[model samples]
Target chain A: MEAGGRLTEDALIARYFAPLAGAGADALRDDAATLTPSPGHDLVLTADAIVAGVHYFPEDPPASIARKALGVNLSDLAAKGALPRGFLLTLALPPDWTEAWLEGLADGLREASEAFGCPLLGGDTVRAAGPALLGITALGEVPAGRMVRRPTAQAGDRICVTGTIGDAALGLALRLTPEAPWAVALTEAERAHLLDRYLHPRPRLALAPALRRFASAAMDVSDGLVGDLAKMLRGAGRGAGVSLAAIPLSPAAASAVAAAPGLLDTAFTGGDDYEILCTVPPGQLDAFRGEALEAGIAVAVIGSVEAEAGAPVFSTEDGAPRAFASGSFSHF
Target chain B: MEAGGRLTEDALIARYFAPLAGAGADALRDDAATLTPSPGHDLVLTADAIVAGVHYFPEDPPASIARKALGVNLSDLAAKGALPRGFLLTLALPPDWTEAWLEGLADGLREASEAFGCPLLGGDTVRAAGPALLGITALGEVPAGRMVRRPTAQAGDRICVTGTIGDAALGLALRLTPEAPWAVALTEAERAHLLDRYLHPRPRLALAPALRRFASAAMDVSDGLVGDLAKMLRGAGRGAGVSLAAIPLSPAAASAVAAAPGLLDTAFTGGDDYEILCTVPPGQLDAFRGEALEAGIAVAVIGSVEAEAGAPVFSTEDGAPRAFASGSFSHF
Candidate 1:
């Protein structure tokens, strides 16, 4: 980590960055990343920061950190119905890490960049006095008039979510308490699957075009189901009532919930789900799910938008409704 | 600084972010920052990170930190011959800072965003177990074929630089050694002027169009003259020899160098100049300067590019040449 040695800043950049010939832009050594605006398309840009100990475990693998950094920003673009085009990375490194750490991190980013069809355009690297921090800015492109927004939901729109929910939350809980009976009883493959989902959640970019075509309002579920839904409701000047029984859960998550009744609280409040949450009109729900399936994304009808402006209500199958102590994870 | 309280994460984002809207992007509050690219213009994007203690003083004002975060990225755009359009900010906050610090930082960003005519498009905030870190991704627009790059400089190009150099370095020296006789003798106005130059650097966006017309290769001097020039030379596959006496120094810097012979070394090696270092053809030098003066930017002919490929050399008044150090500052 010593900056003044055989490998100077310029030398390191030449060694690592110069060889990266990006597909969508000129190589990484340019002053700025250049992009030709496609005809009749608008661009989308979003940046997110992931700090050690706050966003992920301090001992998390470098690859996981890299994936999470790009994944979170891609999730934002997915919510906006923008196809992944490119990204810029800003890395703040601590003094203790070896060069291997950086190389591994960069390898992971390169994998994600190529997989998502987003080239690494430009970025900066700096040394810091504390835990490592990573910041990623993802750029995307969408048809000019088809971008979905959070404030356009209607009163009668049906709420839908993509993919299974609460898997990552359950995975995190297991990681936090590894010695617990449930954690110990899980098969190795199951543990790996859950951990991978938590570490490297794939952004649902394939569903973006269809969502733009059918959904009225859309967003990514970063801060859990009920909390982010409430945000969309507030933004659209409406409210929602979600059915608890209708909440989709993976088989592992269902079994965990059965074992621990309080697991629903964790399911409702845990962050980093990274699934798309949107509202489609009742008449278009079938079409929306049909298109989503064609795009290889699973879909579930979660609830319906309400006419009244108030807190989001979660109703049980037995007609009882109760509020949870916490709605989502908050970083202040 | 606490995670959950009156000024919670949601409340803070609502208070500061809801009112901060970008000019052309309507979905700033949605999942991503939507940008409608102007017709016939390509997009230019760049990202830079500033780490506390490494990039600035630990006690630096929040306003200065915020400005530097955006200013350095804008400096890159200035080098690319792109118009200032919009930017994204990602901040990693230390746990001990007060809410007032966040407010002051946002206020400073807002001030610069308005002044530069670049709106704050989108960003993320997160907690960190380290010093405050700021990452900025700046986006700009340029005509399809006009985005200047560093590989276009030829062997016979006349190396040029904009504005006075060494002031920011001298300012840093003054700040660090306030008790020195030379620093103590400075007038209040001079001291304030020097420090202001260090804190709030104005990116030369106005000169970009003119640079695109005249310069062959362009880049900002973030890493001292010798270091950054070497980078541009590497990009252009050329070599350069700079005349030490020809380097433009402010009057205060000249006095400081005269007072302390080692101040020359500080002036030459100190980073954070934020001025454009470019290469223009010998025949175009006069026209370049004329256009620069008309655009209200000072220009200086400091060196010339050589046909041979080797390390950059700095020649004194008497024509004695020596190899310059590679990097100015060390992150670790």
Candidate 2:
């Protein structure tokens, strides 16, 4: 489980990649992985890369790294309401990894692939001296006309979100300083909840059908809520006003906020939240919530889209507008 | 161009990736690049990575790097007799490259994209500390029944190759030692031919139709004539005898061999020859030559496949064999 040691590329591939089984094109040996498109569905494909250090902790378990790598790409397909088909993985590995680490990583990929109903089709592996990097290209399919896009939101659409926000960011803050006052006071269950959110984010593929049924503009919340929502607004050529008080937080997160007022910064700007942030027309909100409930996804109406462009307004419970120091994580 | 400079990931991406004119998917800007399968042809996809020191001169022009990055993958598809379709590029940039270097690289990609009739589909760009690297996932397609594979060669197959062989290897040697005695004697046309072979290898897509007409199995000779042919034999589950004297060497390469007695080592083991190596049934060799001639491709008989499996035997003009110090490049 050591972060930087114990895996040869060949051994890692054998342990982590060999057992993947599926009914896709040719079973993992050719130069390119192939998938036969289903008759009634449109094929959706996407590729994303996770660089070491920038995306994950260098010391984190390889399994967690693998999950995050594949999970993030799948999350995009989920937002499009596509059914999982298959994926192609490309890896650049540092020479120090042992066989066990790679096996653990592949175990994570296999678990996610099966859990999400997608199977590994093919991939390439190489050696690198720098941090290990991964590029995963995922393929999916959806019935014609069901895929959602970010530029289609209506002026009066209600902005909605799935699950609680800010917890993954909170978990990241705690991991950075485990001895911080907020971290020391957490209950075991709360700590585990935060850690799990940081480690393994579940892409909401199951909710895709309902999303396509009702949502207008849709995208995963990867950058912080304020930033990603702002992007969605820009993509749709609109704007939104969010009720800061209405932003959902776990009980533990609320407690952490109470203890350390600065935790709000983590809540607003920290990235890696994979939950779907979407816009639904006012009349469809009720039906959308009902379907999401049936699908076991937490649904919340946090704001409404504006007809014109402006900065997102955040309001406190007392109707006082609050100020945010930063909007999102900046690559620069 | 210098080899090791730092460039921001965003700046590199902007400089190197032109706005793809007709990319079919919107998810390309979101979390992943998307693809919708084209109807009719079976999609042929393949990815290959070129590391700085391993694949080319550390200080080669970025444009040449860009061309070769894509050209190598196209060569593989060409060997399969597939038409050029589209490509996804993944670039890991060393920090030192300037904006101009990246622009030149993009220009090269754009040139090849147009020349090969493949459009730029999607890709990821990132920064790395070690060597500059490129991973290209090329997608092509052909009619279901026309695609060729390496395992289809039959016994009594008349192994043939398109174009002369040793030019690229000789070019590499000249590039490595520009002032070497052997390189100094080359005329202007010969030097241009050698450098062009090294820098911008034609992928042989033009000969794909003829290959379909005559070749039982085909592949681009990348690793070297001996080694790559060994791979084809392995794929076909057969072995063969090669006449070293019959192997076609370019005029410059022949001169280099005459100048230095051991220069054949460069011809035999040096890599990056992207010419097509194929097997035609003995009875079809005449027809194969006719088709190749009509297509304006040079065809030469090099060897024949036997019903046995082992190391390939290489004999000289007098039928006496000699031992080869090395046959191909091995990453390990």
Candidate 3:
């Protein structure tokens, strides 16, 4: 290939990635980016990497991979109550990579970049011996010292969750086994809903402003609700009383749980949900919910933070503590 | 493994990486980091990844691997004339990763972080099927809108480089074939010098301020000088006239070239120098040199930019041009 041919790194970047660069990216010609934070804001930074087979199947559509990668990082920014700024990408493609696949991924990145309002700043692209891995370092801006953080929830804080839980877990189950016994009971549309949830995570960025205004603490749910919420409280001398029945479930997840009630545990404990799990003080719960409703996001009060030191889940009917095999999935 | 087992992701970060976190990292208690850029400064961001077996030998010391990973990114920021603030890391280790290796890597990171003034802010750790890959997104601070950029070199500008040029190239040569004739002819200290240069890169952070103050255009020499210098001029209607004899070479590299005359080309064409390649207006060259001397960094002027559009090197004696098969090494 000539120096400027599409096969070379410079050509590849200029052809597929530069168009996504914005503002201070210098069209990615400078190999670095400069971000001048607005006077009143601080930068919230988060990085998340997804590997083929581990995070998603190698067969997953390129666009879906892009969505999941950007979605997961954007979700963290949203939970921190920050507005999107831009992102740096690290793409390590396997030796067997083909141009067609790369084009699909680039197109996927363009769509996700535009949708999340996170432009591509710059990135490192190289060929690795392993399966493909896409890592993103996303930058967001929050008013100085106003970023919602963990272990700040008070004893009376009402724990609320945005959107529904367990959809991702159910989606993964369906992907792993299209003929899962419970899946067989679902209609085609239900199956598609579950799969889409697993494939494309819709970040709840619309609620970011309200989160910083009203949330005492907040975290994005990635490693399941039970474990992630526990993480938010683990480092501090605090506990939470959660009603599993109050954890909103999507219509598809509800259908799956109805067909096989045991799947309820999977819904609550399985990972890859990107919704925001936050705590609102008793005084702010009404306004928080009102804002979430205005943002057109589903807000449900799942439980409350307590002075106790361990997480306890109840069915909310007879109020009996339930046992689970594990709190969340472990990559190790 | 238990939830807090050392093998688990959370435990791994807490045990080995969390201590490196500083300032807004919240001690890694939060999964993400917040960087509050000081007013009047812009955040200069850059990311680079090094994969084992591709960027380094799988058998290379874990500490050496860590140094290279941090050094390369820090070098970019240095070239940008930005002061290091903090960095985010993405570590994907192979399935066979050991605790001892991880411990060594962490210690290396601690040392580099302290030395570079760039603390670890946050990171993501995952397991991959292939060799380990270390990715870092480093942030630096520079005066707003003052970042020195590429393709800005003007005709009559002097081309300068810091430190010795080809030690890394020779070092890599020894590492691959310690029994080569050239290796057998070198002194023990000479061999060690070359190997050390290859194993650990010393980022010239000291020259950063001087670069931004005086350089019209600049870039780090990660790839060979021949190619990278060409890159600096390729986008613009500019070229350079370099005197090959003026290119600085360490005693070790000079010895290697004497033993194998052809190695001169490799010296100029090899990668991983991590030194700054910059252009200064002729009128400011003396002042730039003085500042570099104050910083205790060796700076050499080897070439001059011209209105012509291609990079051509001459042997000052005869003023004859030399031909090379390729300019820089292609990662692909």
Which numbered prediction scores highest in TM-score against the true structure?
Answer: 3
Q: After superposition, how far is residue A267 of candidate 3 from its true place, in Å?
A: 0.8
Residue lDDT tens for model 1, A136-212: 88888888867788878898999999998888877888889877777677777767766777888789999998888
Candidate 3 lDDT, A1-332, residue by residue in tens = 55443488888888889999989998999968999878889999999899998899999988789888899999999999999999999999897877788888988999999998999998899789998999899999999999899778888889999999999889999887778789999999999988888899888999999999999999999998888888888865688888878889988999999999988888888888899999999999999999999999889998988888776555556788777777877544
Flag the better candidate by lDDT, 2 or 3. Answer: 3
True contacts kept of each: 0.86, 0.27, 0.70
What DockQ does each listed candidate score? 0.75, 0.37, 0.77
Candidate 2: where is the Cα deviation over 4 Å? A1-18, A21-27, B1-18, B26-34
Overall lDDT per candidate, in order of appearance: 0.81, 0.77, 0.89
Reference-based TM-score, model 3 = 0.98
lDDT of 1 by residue, B105-143 (tens): 888887888888788888887778888888889999888
| Models sorted by TM-score, best on top | 3, 1, 2
Between 2 and 3, whose DockQ is larger?
Answer: 3
Per-candidate TM vs. native? 0.96, 0.90, 0.98
Model 3 global lDDT (CA atoms, 0 to 1): 0.89
Residue A141, model 1, lDDT: 85
Per-residue lDDT of candidate 3, residues B210-279 (tens digit): 9999999989998889999999988656988898888999999999999998898778889899999999
Writing each residue's lDDT as its tens digit, candidate 2 over A102-198 gives 7778888888888888888766677776777777777778786567887778888988889888888888888889999889988888888888888
lDDT of candidate 3 at residue A184, scale 0 to 100: 94
